[model samples]
Target: MAQKNYGKKLLLVVLGSTVMGIGIYLTIIANFGSDPLTMFWIGLSNRLGITIGQANLLVSALMLIVVFFMDRKEIFIGSILNPLVISVTTDFLLRQTITIDSVGLRMMFFILGLLILAFGIAVYSLADFGRGAYEALVFSLNQLFKRSIRIFRILCDISFAIAGILLGAQLSIGPVMAILLMGVSIQFFINHLSRPIYHYLNK
Candidate 1:
């Protein structure tokens, strides 16, 4: 059997998603903006007469369409729950403020927030329950281009970020950091945690 059991995988998915939401909250708190995907959702929500949460739902729906065509299996499970979980979870957590009254405190939260996001994604992938929308799309692009996952991720993220910015999506320090750091962070955390965390979760 795979080292990670189904129950453990489910737990990790929820945990990872929760962390992703926290990271979004941190970006909002930092006042430094969020990633392109996030910015796109927020902007779409604002302009299209939808709540940010609802906008996220819409984005997930569109991505699921692409994902189903690109990799039917990967989209199969996540399509059912990942977007709904991420959208609702992020909205709830981000709405709850973690008040920080100082610049130093805010900066600290920013860095910590990034790390939390990394851990969440790492756990989510390590669990291997299903692929997140962004991750799945990057993997699909890599397969299509016959390129490395890392390289493809970087390229896609940059392209998406630029596009989101051009479309009047929020683009600032937090998002810039996310664009630069998310890939490396996810890679690092996944590599380091996959086996050990899986083993621990199973047992």
Candidate 2:
């Protein structure tokens, strides 16, 4: 029984994490804008002349170090799996993007990307694997500042977005929309989706 549960949990973790990768990929291929963290990763990729997935993993690894020092407990299997899977998934999807000539279609992709991203995040989180490096960073910052995690998250997004823009990453109203909506959207999912999922996993 426990064995069955573990397998299901692992599958959920992988699927949830990979869906997140797909969402990020769609947002990038849309070429409108991306979430700040993604935008920052893209900037790193450009400046470093590596794939965006490579840059994302590199940053996640670096953040893991910081989180390790701040709170070791925050690091979990999901922390490693989350970045590794997403990195691979993103790079794999990179070659799959098609050239879209229609603005309306592009906007639809962008919107779909945002919704998918929120759903992926919520699902991944519900898997009970662990916090990713970025999530850990938010937790650590909240502890350090003794403020709201939501506030720190938004601030982090804004900071990363600015840095990404400075590094020649493109900007659009997209990042703004992401910043404004992501937390709310995640909560919306958690509110609606968590109970059923948690029951299934016995979480």
Candidate 3:
């Protein structure tokens, strides 16, 4: 029974990570900007002349190092898989040239990307395998400082957004939308989607 449960959780982690990757890819192809972490990676990629996937892997690795010190308990197999899976999947999707000429269509894609991203987050959280590197950092900081997770998240996003901007990544509406909606979306998914799935799986 324990083995079965572990396998199920591992499967959920992979599924959630893959979905998140697709969402990330869609957001990137939408060309409306990206989430702060992604923006940071994109900025670094542009400045350092590396692929975005490479930048993502490098940044995630560095963040994981910090997470290792701050909260070793959060480290798990999922932690190792999250970054690699998301980056690789994003890179694969990005290889296809998906373009939208109309602003409305582009915005539609952007919104869809947000929904998918949120859903992925919700599913990933449900898996409860482990938090991703950036998320683990936020969780650890919250624990250390006794601050609300929301505040730390906002601060992280702002810092990354600014750094990305400074590095010559274009600022756009995508980050703003992500900041505003992601929390709400995650909550919605947790309450409405993941919990039910968890119940079903457990039963």
Candidate 4:
């Protein structure tokens, strides 16, 4: 069975990738303890004496390998495309040297980043082009347990935060708020956003 509207799916993947990258960059620059996975990345980087980028790659690769055995079908174009596109987008943005000085403004960026990140994740996940290693695990658990992804996602988020803390990553209000909201945010998009995307694709 051939997949229809694969080109559109790919577009979604790219858009999601770029959006996710921007979201990630914003969250990090906001500096409110960063995103959950990012907290873990920082911990891993410091623990291993490697660059943050190196730690990120290592974690993602290991995650991808795990998902590969868990459900290879979830490994698709987006799986590869997600990290590459996000890395490029974030790298470029980093070079821009974006900075926010206002506490209020930083908070705004964090909130916006969290929402956009979840939306981006939903867009690409709905595209059926596979998912990033982090999200692949989320959805894979959804399939395996036949439960709501929100529950699994919440657990995953908290677990990462705890691990990051254990590894010396500071916990803050921003990441804590994000940990609570991220799962709900992603599910919200999957619920609301999937309709239009799938509608366009099926047409």
Model 1 pairs whose backbones collide: none
Error of 3 at 191 (Å): 1.0
- What does candidate 2's lDDT look like per residue over 89-171, in tens digits? 99999977588779899888988888888888898888777798999999987887799998988888999999999988998
Displacement of residue 153 (Cα, Å) in model 1 is: 2.2
User: Local error of candidate 2 at 13, Å?
Assistant: 1.3
Q: Is candidate 1 or candidate 4 better by lDDT?
A: 4
lDDT per residue, candidate 1, 1-203, as tens digits?
A: 45347666677777777777777667667666677677777677667877667877887787767877887667645445666777787788766757778988887777777888788778777766668877777777777778899797767667766766776676678777777787788899988887798577768
In terms of lDDT, which candidate is stronger, 1 or 3? 3
Please name the candidate that would achieve the greatest lDDT relative to the true structure: 2
Candidate 2: where are CA atoms >4 Å away? Answer: none
- Model 1 spans with C-alpha error above 4 angstroms: 1-4, 97-101
Which pairs in model 4 have colliding backbones? Answer: none
The candidate 4 region of ten consecutive residues with least summed lDDT is 50-59
Q: Which stretches of candidate 3 lie over 4 Å from their true place?
A: none
TM-score of each: 0.84, 0.95, 0.95, 0.84
lDDT for 31 in candidate 3 is: 84
- Candidate 3 has a TM-score of 0.95
RMSD of 2: 1.6
